[model samples]
Target: MRFLAHTECFFGKSRYDDLHSALGNTITGTGIALIDTAVVDSAAVRDLLSQVEIHFGNAIPVSAVSVLSEPTYDQLDDLAALVRQSDPSFILAIGGGSLLDLAKGVAVLLENPGLARDYRGMGLVKKELRTMICVPTTAGTGSEATWTASFIDDQTRIKLGINGPNVFPKYALLEPALLVGSPRKVALSAGLDSLVHAVEAVSSPLATPPATALAVKAVALITKHLPVALNSEEEDSWSGVQMGAYLAGLAMLNSPGGIASGVSYPVGTQFHVPHGFAGGIILPYVIDFNTTRGYRGYELLNPEMGSNRTFYQQIEELYGILNVPRNLSEWGATGEPAIRTLRELTLNQRSGSFNYNPIPFDEADLNSLLHLICQAD
Candidate 1:
């Protein structure tokens, strides 16, 4: 329930200090803003900092800044060292999923090392973090807003995560302006991730009313805004995208997402596709698969689901709004060779995402689902 952003979110300007004040942390942080991004090296954070300096004077006092340069392996090593060394006040991450997730992993591992894998299934971290704040940039992943961190286990090559309320940031900074300038492609891929968040939340086995409500709001927002943002030469309407992304995060915080978002980590790690795109491609197929196979959680929202949309139309509309391919082949994946591996990975996933899928799937069921995604038109 506690997002790193101020629980009472502020719309304009840098509410960073206010968030800090509310959280009562003023100094050291493992901050990773887009400016610190290794993928593209964004200057947006620098510009935002400059403006802050202009308005509030010179000293930009932060605890520490951790740039996101490494993939999974090195990042965890670096994070572990930080906790072992300084014992800093907290970790504040400001980047995309990887960056935010890095912060979460660091915060949790520092405190709980004995039963690390025990925390793997869900709700296991059971401890408080060293303090943390998540400032999301791409408006997807919702890492800043969620309470769990997704990570890969290198040796097993199976996807896994460390979860608990402790992994959730002390605040989730929802700065719509911070998200405004990202390129359309990055925005869209991430937006699609959010759409998946909403859809899966609706049918997710983890369904709770609060989580379901958030997903619906997210779907409505994205359905209305993503296309406009995607096509405009200058997307002055970025706030809609930003809000949509936040709602998706909120939805997942509740329902956690089903198999598509669940299955994506394996695909991302094994196939080398980025997580957003990996998750995006599997979503529609999951919805299609679920339509005939399991209980649609949206039944709780029947009046709005209209028998057609929530059952069928709602899902069809999501794919259209995101403009994604209906199959994995469209995303360049081919054949049935990967199905077994996918099933292996799906079994590894166990709870967080796969458990919430509309239907309970065994190895054969998973293989079938992947085939549908691979072959669907």
Candidate 2:
């Protein structure tokens, strides 16, 4: 079994303060802070920025920028250029997956000699990236723990991840307080994204024993806590979901994702669907397809469900509780033409995921899956 070391994680109610204190003492040079626009105006973020200014003082000159969701390659190049002028010692990413991804891309570009597009595939980064500390406000993509940063290629309109060991964040700060006031839809989508990650990781053919263990525990935690985190204001619930998401991300570091992840990229890039929502929506169908073909790996994900209902059914029930749609029709991807387009795009852009999937899903299988995903609920 292969094992990969990941980010050093700090978890708690006020871990951000701890991070600030640690960095303030250690970092004597300039740094760049990327904040998600969604939470830029929040009191928590405001206070966090205030603390950054106070703690760092003159020792570290920090520049803050607001980033939007679903960053593109152009945005990465532009942000890298802006940060290059500062010659930052580190990057502090505060936000959800997209902002965190943007921060990772910027970090890669700062130290690498070429443009962001030059390193779109795996193991292309010859230089170590500047230190990146990811502070995720949401419990979704687990970008803080993962070693890949996804972005859209504006020239081709394709979503590709800049993947390698260099993309891993040096530190991850999981503070549940930051997730307290997120919109229900945003929180649910993010939680479901983590759920899909855990499920897919466990089901991947490349999954090691350690990776499966983490993914299984992540699945259990997400299934139990995501609903509570969404419905209640309890920090513990959010913490549970957040830890689950982080574990899922770590698991996925060793195991590649399956058809659901492959489908998400095309659907998200073409239809403007949120990545997490698109993956979550199609996950159940993918599970069903696998199980019908004699893949029983998912039974381990939620062993507590027993034999009364299949694991996929339980996931569907969770979606019902969360009020997430079952397909991409809501994003205007319903017709046959949409399915064909998504199939071609998924084949071209994300074939690696399919190659690693436990079940060998060919073009016909992909077409079928896309039909299921684009079908009306």
The prediction achieving the highest lDDT against the true structure is: 2
TM-score computed on alpha carbons, candidate 1: 0.78
Model 1's lDDT to the true fold? Answer: 0.64
Candidate 2 runs further than 4 Å off: 13-25, 50-68, 304-308
The alpha-carbon deviation from the true structure for residue 120 of candidate 2, after best TM-score superposition, in angstroms, is 1.7
**C-alpha TM-score for every candidate:** 0.78, 0.93
Q: Which stretches of candidate 1 lie over 4 Å from their true place?
A: 1-35, 38-43, 50-74, 82-90, 109-127, 233-236, 293-311, 314-322, 330-332, 351-355, 359-364
lDDT of 2: 0.83
lDDT of 2 by residue, 1-377 (tens): 77886687877755656776666556666677777777877888766666556766743344455665578889889988988888888887889988899989999988898799999989898887788778899999989988899988887888888998888888888878789878988888898889888898899888999999999999988888888888888988988999999998888888888888878888888999988899988888888888889988887865754446789788878778888897887889997999888878887878778876787788888888888888876
Candidate topping TM-score: 2
Worst 10 residues of 2 by lDDT: 58-67
Write the residue-wise lDDT of candidate 1 on 150-178 in tens digits. Answer: 76666765656776566766666665555
